[model samples]
Target: MANDKTSHEIGIDGAILATQVPGNNGTLILSIQQTSALNNWLLKWANYLQNEQTPRNEWLMTTILIKSKSLKIEHKIAGVSPQKIPDSQYQAQGQRVTWVLMAADIQTT
Candidate 1:
């Protein structure tokens, strides 16, 4: 179907649960299924921000996209700083973690 597109075409990065971008503040909390690949990806950005040396923490910026059959959303987070990650524990199936991060700028589209 040339004119038909499903949520499957959005190319989700991983098994996402939910996303929260609270108000005008540059804060984003993302909840997703816990996996080694996803853990590494999140930690990579957090570590980069931690190691970066710059004033106002403006050295880093990243974009997050959310898609579904009825809605399409995007958020641009800048100067992101790692906030929290779950501790190591033996969790059963469908265990999810909310990754907290703060940024200098949070743009929406």
Candidate 2:
């Protein structure tokens, strides 16, 4: 997905913005700005994750890679305040609602 497009154009880029590996477990962090479109997308994505048995059902897991492999990650809708960026930081970007989601990956060697 092109970075230049406004958040409205793309619901969420299935990108792992950051990652951390500790022992056999991995953590993936993704950020999405809160736009009307993004809010709708998040709800659908979260529902799928919660209801689907196959982790592969999640588009983000299929599209995002960690350590050159598709990760079976578990996620939760983290509270908004901790993940929220200060208005001062996002005002210029026109992003009022922002969320940081963390996905946990259990890796088997």
Question: TM-scores of all models?
Answer: 0.50, 0.29
lDDT of 2 by residue, 48-104 (tens): 656557365353452333342466553332121122322323354545444444433
* Weakest ten-residue segment in model 2 by summed lDDT: 77-86
The residue ranges of model 2 lying beyond 4 angstroms of the native Cα positions read 1-22, 36-39, 52-63, 66-109
Stretches of candidate 1 off by over 4 Å are 1-23, 51-59, 63-73, 92-94
Top-TM-score candidate index: 1
Query: Whole-model lDDT for model 2 versus the true structure?
Result: 0.40
Backbone clashes for every candidate come to 0, 1
RMSD of each: 15.2, 17.5
lDDT for each residue of candidate 1 in 1-109, tens digit (9 for 90 to 100): 0122223322377664544333444567777767757876987666665664644434445555444546666665565666765554466765667787666666667
Computed on alpha carbons, the lDDT of every model, listed in order, comes to 0.58, 0.40
